[model samples]
Target chain A: MRVLGVDPGLTRCGVGVVEGVAGRPLTMIGVGVVRTPADADLGHRLVAVEQGIEQWLDEHRPEFVAVERVFSQHNVRTVMGTAQASAVAMLCAARRGIPVALHTPSEVKAAVTGSGRADKAQVGAMVTRLLRLSAPPKPADAADALALAICHIWRAPAQNRLQQAVALHTAKAPKGRTA
Target chain B: MRVLGVDPGLTRCGVGVVEGVAGRPLTMIGVGVVRTPADADLGHRLVAVEQGIEQWLDEHRPEFVAVERVFSQHNVRTVMGTAQASAVAMLCAARRGIPVALHTPSEVKAAVTGSGRADKAQVGAMVTRLLRLSAPPKPADAADALALAICHIWRAPAQNRLQQAVALHTAKAPKGRTA
Candidate 1:
C-alpha cells in the first residue's frame, strides 16, 4: 500500500510518500514542499497551494493520505493557518476518492521515537537512524514527514496482525462467530 | 517581491510561485503539486515530499512563502496529518532563508471574492479570470494557491495606497519623523 504523509503549513507544507508493509519498505517515491510568497495576497497564496497539490497528485496518486493532527498553538493566527492548510489536504484527498487519516503529534512521536514527547532533534536523529541513512533528512520538516509515514505503518492494520487474524478466524467460522 | 503560495496535503500539496512589485500585477513563475503514495509508511511519504519541495526551491527560489492557515477538523486523524504537512512547509522555507506567511481561508477568499464565504469553484474561476489565463488552474488546490498569492498582493502596503494613507493618518505622523 502507498501512503502519503503530510506536515501542513501555510507558507510551507511538507509531504512524503511511502509504499511498503512490515518487513519490507517501498521506495521513498518522492518528497517536497509547496511555497507561497509573502506580500502577495492570501488569494494568491491559496492558488499556489492548490496548484502544488494538483501536480503532486498527478505524480503520486496515493491510495491513502495520513496527516498530523494539531492540538494547540500559542499563536492564534498560526493555528488558524495550520487548520486551513489541514483542510486543504483533506479536501484534496476527498476529491480524489482517497482515504485520509490523521495522527496527533504525540502519536507520531511515540510511533517513531517510542516517546510521545520527543523533541525535533531527537526525532530527526531517530528517523535517520531508523531509516538507516547516511545523513539525516535536511530541514526538520522532512524528518517530521518521515515520522508521520512511519506512524502510519505502525498504525495500519497490517502492522497489527492480531486483529487481522482474529477477523479472518471469525469470518471463516461463519455467521455470529467470535474469535 | 516574489511570493510562493502553498496548499498543504499528505499526497499532494499545491504550490504556486508568483513575482510582482507591490501594487503591480503578480506574474506566475511556476505552479505544481508535490505528490506521494497514500498507503506507504509515513517516513517514506515525508521523504518524497522533502525531495520534491527541495527541487522546487532550487528551481524557483522565491523571496517569500505563503500558505493557507490550517483549521480544526473533527476527525482527529485527519487534523494531525494536516498539521504535520504545515510544519513541513515552514521548515522548507526556514531552510531556504525565505520568510513564510500564513493566511486563513476566509482571508484568501475575501481578498479575491470580497467575501470570506466564497466557495472553491467561485474562488477558482475568479483566480483564473484575474490571472487572465485561458483556463482555470487545474484542480481546486492549485486555484486556491493562486488565490493566496492574489490575496497577499491585494493586502500589500505598496499595492494599497489608500490603506497606507489611512495608517499614516492614524499614526499621527509618528513622533516628528520627516514626512
Candidate 2:
C-alpha cells in the first residue's frame, strides 16, 4: 500500500509519499515541504497549505494518509497552528475518500527507530537506511513525514487485525454494564 | 456589514449570521447548529463540519466570518477538536475571499453584555434585547455565535485603525538597533 504522510505546520508543512507493505521494501515516491510566510494572513496561509496538499494528493495518489496527532504544547499559538494544518490534511484526504490515520510523535519514533525516546538524528539515520537513500531528506520536517508514513505502513496491518477482533467480539456479545 | 459567526465544536458547531453596522441595530439572518455523531470517524466528522460551513457561506454570503478563538483547556482532546473545527471555519471563509476575525469568549461576552465575565444567561438576555427577539436563541452555542458577530461588528473599526497606524509607523521607520 502507498501512504502519504504529512507533518502539519503553519509555516512549513512536510509531505512525503511512500509505497510499501508490511515485511517488504519501501520506495520513496516524493518528499517536499509547503511553506507560508510568517507575516501572511492566517486565512491565506491555510489556503496555501490546502492547495499544496491537494497538489501532492493529485500527483502521488496515495491510498492512505498519515498525519501527526497534535498533543498539548506549552505554546498555545504553535499548537493551534499545528492542529489547524492537521485538520486541513485530514479534510483533503476525506474529500478524496482516502482513509487517514493519526500517529503520535512517540509512536512514530518507536516504529522507525525501535525506541520511543529516539532523537531526531536517530530517526533520520533509520529513515535513510530503510529507504536506501544516500542522504536523509532535508529540513527535519521532511524526514519526519517519511517516518510517519513508515510507521503507519508497518503498524496498520497489526492494527487492522486487532480492530477486526474487537468488532467480532462486540458482535457476539450482549449489551452489559460490566467493564 | 454582514457577518457570519461560528462557535467551533466537534459534536455541535453553532453558526449564526447578522447584518448591521457599528452603533446601529442588528438583524438576525440565521442561526443553527451543525452536529456530527459521536461514533463517527474523525475525518468524517470534520468533513461534515466543512460541508456545514460551506453551505452557510453560500447561503448567507456574509462579508466577514467570525470564529471563536480556541484557548488552552484542561481537556486536551476537547481543545484539539475545537481548534480543528475552528480551522475548518476559517478555511471556508478564506476560500470565498471573505475576511475572517477571531474573537475570544470573553471578548464576545464583553461586547454583548458589557462585562468580560458575564454568564451565559446574561449574554443570551442581551442578545435577545439587541436583536429584538421575543426569546433567546436555542442552545447556548447559538447565542455565543451571535455574540461573536456582534463583537466583530463593533470592534473591527477600532482594530483596523490600530493596524493601519502600526503599518504606517513601520513603513516610515528605519531599520535600526534602537527599539
Candidate 3:
C-alpha cells in the first residue's frame, strides 16, 4: 500500500509519502512542506496549500492518504487555519479517488514508538530505526507524518475485512429471486 | 457582498446564498440541499458534492463564503465523508478567488443566539427571529448555515480590518526593487 501522510499548518504544512508491501518495509517516496510566510494573507496561504498538495500529488501519486485529525487549539484563528489546511489536503485526495484515513497524534505516536505520550524526538528516533533510514526525517512534523502513514497501514486491516464481508453479503443477496 | 454558506454532507449538503450590503441585513437569494445515496461509492459522493457546489456558485455568483468547519466526529468513516464534503466546498470558493471563512458550531451558535452553549432548538428559534422568517427554516443545518453567513456579515468589520492590514503590509514589502 502506498500512503501519503499530511500534517496541516498555515505557515508550513508537512507531508510524507510512503509505499509498503505486505511483508516488506515501506520506502519513502518524498517528504516536504508547503510553506507561506506568517505575514501572508489568509487567501494566499490557502492558495499555497492547494498548490502544494496538487504539486505533490502529481509527482508521487499515492493511492492512500493519512492526515492528522482536527485537534483543538487555544487560538480560534489558528484552529480555523488548521481546519482549512486539513480541508485542502482531504480534498486533494478525494479528487483522485484515493482513500483517506485520519489518525490522531497519540494513535500515530503509539503505533510508531509504542507509547501514546511519546515526544516528537522519540517518535522520530523510532521512525528512523523502524524504517532503518540513513538519517532521521527533518522538521519533526514531516517525520510525524511519515510515522502516521505507517500506523494507518498497521491499523487498516479492519477496513479490508469489513469491505470483504460487505462484498460477500451483497454477492449472495437475493436480487430478483422470489422467496 | 454576496456570501455563500455551505453545510456539507455526503448524502445531502445544505447550501444558502445571501447578499448583504455594508450596512444592510443579509437577504437570502437561495437555499437547498444536494443529495447523493448513502450506498454510492466514495467517488460518486465526492462528485455530487463538487457538482452541487459548482451549480450553486454558477447561479449565485457569490463573492465570499462561510463554511461550517467539520470537527472531530464519533465515526471515522463519517468524518472522512464530511471532510471530503468540506474540501469540495472550499475548492469551489477558492477557484473563484472568493475568500472563505471557517466557523465552528459554537461560534455560529453564539453569533446567532448570543450564547455559545445554546441548544439546537434555541438556535433555530433565534435564527428565525433574527432573519425575520415567517416560520423556522427547514433542516436546522440549513438554517444554521444561513445563520453562519449572516454572522460573517455581522462580524465583517474585523474580517475587513485583517484583510486591509495584510494588504497594507504586502504593499510596503520590498519587491522587485533596484539593488
Candidate 4:
C-alpha cells in the first residue's frame, strides 16, 4: 500500500509518501514541505496550501492520505492554522476518492519510536534509520510526516479488519434501526 | 456591491447574500443554510461545505465573500469544526479570485446594532430592519450570516481607504526598509 502522510501547518505543511504494508520494509518515495508566507492574507494562504497539496497528490498518487489529527488543546494561537491546513489536505485527498486517515501525534510517535512520549529527535532518528537514510529529514515536521506514514502503514491491517467487521455487521442488521 | 456571507459550521453552515453599498437601502438577495450529516467523515463534510459555498457564489455572483472569523475561545468541541468550515469557505472564494473578508461576531453585531456585545436576537432584529424583511432570518446562524455581509458592505469604504493609504505609504517608502 502507498500512503501520503501530512503534518499539516499553515506556515510549513510537511508531506511524505511511503510505500509498504505491515511486516514489510517500507520505502520512502518522497518527502517535502509546503510553505505559505506568514504575511499573506488568510484566504490566499489557503489557496496556496491547496495548490501545493494538489501538486503533491498529483506527483505521488498515494492510495491513502494520513494527516495528523489536529486537537484544540495545542497552542491556541497555532491550533486554528493547523486545523485549517489539515482540512485542506484532507479535502484534496477526499476529492480524489483516496481514503483519508487521521492519526494523532502520540500515535505516530508511538508507532515509530515504541513510546508515545518520544521526543522530536527520537522520531527524526527513527525515521532516518527506518528509511535507511544517512541523515534525518530536515525540519522536524518532515520527519513527523514520515513517522505518520509509517504508523498508518503498520496499523492499516487491523484498522481494515475492524472496518470490514463493522461493515459486515451493518449490512446484516435491520435497515434504518439504531444498534 | 454584492457580498456573500458565511457563518461556518460543520453541521449547519449559514450563508447569505446582500447587495448595496454603505449608508443606503440594502437588499437581502439570499439567506439559507448548508447542512452536512454529523456522522459523515470530516473530509466529506469539508467537500460538502465547499460545494455549498460554491453554489452560493455561482448563484449570486457576489463581488466579495464575507466569512465569520472563528476563535478558539468558544466552545472547545465546536471551535475546531468552525475553523475547518471557515477555511473551506475562504478557500472556495479565494480559488475564484473573489476578495474574502473575515468579520468577527462582535464586529458583525456592532456594525448592525451599535454594540459589539449585542445579543444574537438584537443583531437578527437589526438585520431584519436593515434589509426591510418582514421577519428575522430563520436560524440565528442565517441572521448572523446576513449580518456579516452587511458589515462587510458597510466597512468596505473605510477598509479600501486604509488599504490605499498603506499601499501609498509602502510605495513612497525606501525599498528593503522596515516601516
Best by the lDDT measure: 4
Between candidates 1 and 4, the one scoring higher on DockQ is 4
Q: Pick the candidate with the highest TM-score.
A: 4
Q: Quality of candidate 3's docking, in CAPRI categories?
A: incorrect
Q: How big an interface RMSD has model 3?
A: 10.5
| B1-179: candidate 2 lDDT, tens digit per residue | 88899999978899999999999999999988887667766776788888888888888998788899898765777999999989889888876667778899989999999999999999999999999999999799888898899898899686745544543443322111100
lDDT tens string, model 4, B55-117?
888888987888999999889999999999999998888777677788898899899999999
The sequence of per-residue lDDT tens digits that candidate 3 reaches over residues A59-164 is: 8887677888875533445655676677777766755656667788889988888899999899989888877788888888789878977887778667945644
Give the worst 10-residue stretch by lDDT in candidate 4 chain A.
Answer: A170-179
Off by over 4 Å in 4: A161-179, B161-179
Clashing residue pairs in candidate 3, if any?
Answer: none
Q: Lowest-scoring 10 consecutive residues by lDDT in candidate 3 chain A? A: A170-179
Per-residue C-alpha lDDT of model 1 across residues B9-93, encoded as one tens digit per residue: 7667777777776566667777777776776534345445555666777788876667777766435556555555665666566
Candidate 3 regions with alpha-carbon error over 4 angstroms: A41-44, A71-80, A155-179, B7-13, B20-27, B34-50, B68-88, B101-134, B150-179
- At residue A70, candidate 1 shows an lDDT of 58
A170 in model 3: Cα distance from truth in Å?
Answer: 15
After the best TM-score superposition of candidate 3, give how far the Cα of residue A108 lies from its true spot, in angstroms: 2.6
State which candidate has the highest DockQ.
4
> How accurately is candidate 3 docked according to DockQ?
0.15
Model 1 alpha-carbon drift over 4 Å, by segment: A1-179, B73-75, B158-179
Residue by residue across A1-179, what tens digits does model 2's lDDT show?
88999999988898899999988999998998988778866776777788889889988998888999998665776998999999999988876667778999999999999999999999999999999999999888999999999998999686745544443443322211100
* lDDT of model 4 at position B127: 96
DockQ, computed on Cα atoms, for candidate 4: 0.26
